[model samples]
Every structure is written in structure tokens, then in C-alpha cells.
Target: MTESDDIRSTLIDMLEELDDRLARITDDVKHTQEPLAKDSEEQAIPVENDEVLDYLGNSTRTETDQVNRAIAKLEQGHYENCEACGEHIAKERLEIVPFARLCVRCAEKSEE
Candidate 1:
């Protein structure tokens, strides 16, 4: 299969995994609304639980957004190029992060 097809498949897999994780996070936070005695003991701080849930929610949103952007790039016919420098992103990097938007050099520069 072509590299585009492989990355497309990877993005699909990541999206599915994210969906499952978000669902589980939702379930975990929802059930804690009325914590049982054992659960209450296990979770000494309700605020901590809330914080964890919030963090997970934010992380899930970010990942979902990235995955969607990757899929859009794939559809737009430039999934292999860096959005910032118009250079081809390394295949190795794309294999690791299929939604990457910058080549290594540009990405490193942007970090500065």
C-alpha cells in the first residue's frame, strides 16, 4: 500500500482508540458523581478526581483535533508535506505522528 494509505489507516486507528478512551474517561467520571463507600475511600479527594477528569477531557479534545486535521490533510492531497516549510516530512516522523504539520527542522525552529 502507498504511504498515504498507511498513514490514513494509522489515523483511523488512532481516532478509534481516542474514541474508546474518551468514552471510558466519561464513564469513569460519570460514575464518580455518587461514589460508593469503597470508592470514596479509594478516592480521598473529589477535587482530584475532577481535575483528572478535566485533564483527560482536554487531552482527548486535543488528540481528536489533531487526528481530524491529519485526515483533512490526507484528503487535501498534501499529507506528506510540512504545513510550515513545504518540505516533505520524514517518513519516520510521519510513521510516529501521522498528523504532524511540520518537517523536523521547521518543527524544531517553531519550538524555539
Candidate 2:
């Protein structure tokens, strides 16, 4: 397979693994919530379970969406090209962040 195809496959695998891990974490957290609540007083700062769950859930959703979007971009003949300059993104960077939409130069300039 080509490099972009390889990257896409790896990212798909990573995202699926993340989804499984997040589901397990969510269930474990839910199971612990009741015991945690029973011991803590109401006035004791709320454990912020909702906030934590929301953050974790949103993160997983966003990551899944991003992975799908990246794959779509690949199919549409745009993979590895910087969105801003249309230059090929370095393979090293792509290896680090398979969903990257910008090359290092464009990304660096944007941070200014």
C-alpha cells in the first residue's frame, strides 16, 4: 500500500482502539460514581462526574469524526497536502499526526 493508505489504515486502527478504551473507561467511571457519591457529603464539592464524562465523551466523538474526515479527504485527492498552501505535508509529521491538515511551514506560520 502507498504511504497515505498506510497512514489511513493505521489511524483507523488507532481510532477504533481509542473507542474501545473510552467505552471501558466510561463504564468503569459510571460504576464507581455511586460508591463515590454515597460516601461524600452533598456540600463536598460535587465530583464533577458530569463534566468529566462530557469531556471524555466529546473527545472520543471528535476524534472519530476527525478520523473519518481525514479518510474522506484522502479519497477526495487531498491527502498529505497542506490546506493553506497545497504543499505536501512531510511524511514524518504525517506519521506523528496522521490527521494533520497542514505542513510544518504552514502550521508554523499560522501559530504566529
Candidate 3:
């Protein structure tokens, strides 16, 4: 009903989607190095198994950390405020990046 609830619900939905995709990546990593029989086709995947595993692990960690930070911001009553300037974050920007920590102006300045 309220704007905060809407944002929270949206973020939860996004996090759930990320979790599902991360689970699939985990499965892929688990099966990437399946033992091949002597007669089985010796096919090398385009990416190295170790590299894929590392990449998947890092990606999952990053996503989880971002989700956690968003949840933390909500709990701390800072969800709609920019961390850098303490200004209210624009709804448009928040809709696009629910985990954003800065407003457009501050974000642009920081990038410079």
C-alpha cells in the first residue's frame, strides 16, 4: 500500500530471482568437472572448469552481499535515502536499482 512496502516487495522479488539463478549456476559448477570415462568424448568446454567455478562463486557472493545490504538499509530506515548526501533518492532511480546507495547528482559527482 505504501511506497516503502512497494519498494520492499520489489526488492524481495528481485532477490528471489537472483537466488534461483545462483542455484542454477551452483549446479553447473558442481557438474562441470564430471569424471569422463576412457571412451567418453573428451570435450573441453569453452571456459575452464576452475575459471567457471571461481566466477560463479564470486558472482553469487556479490549478489548475496548486495541483497543483504539492501535489506540492512531497509531495516535501518535508510532505504529511500542516499548514503552519500543523505537526500531522498528519486523513485525512478530506486525503481531501476533497488539497491542503489546514491542519488543521481551524488552518483554523477562520485563518478567524476
Encode model 2's per-residue lDDT on 25-92: one tens digit a residue.
68867764654445557535435666777688888888888778778888888878898999999989
Worst 10 residues of 3 by lDDT: 38-47
Can you tell me which runs of candidate 2 are displaced by over 4 Å?
32-46
Please report, as a residue range, the 10-residue window in candidate 2 with the lowest summed lDDT.
37-46
> What is the lDDT for 92 in model 2?
93
lDDT of 3 by residue, 15-78 (tens): 8887887888788777766766766655565257668777877887787788778888998898
Q: What local distance difference test score does each model get?
A: 0.88, 0.80, 0.81
TM-score of predicted structure 3 = 0.79
What is the lDDT, from 0 to 100, of the residue 7 in candidate 3? 74
Better of 1 and 2 by lDDT: 1
* Highest lDDT model number: 1
Candidate 3 clashing pairs, residues 3+ apart or interchain: none
Q: Rank the candidates by lDDT, best first.
A: 1, 3, 2
Q: Model 1, range 1-112, lDDT digits (tens) per residue?
A: 9877877888999999999999999998888787568745666777788899989989998989999998998999988889987989998998888889899999999999
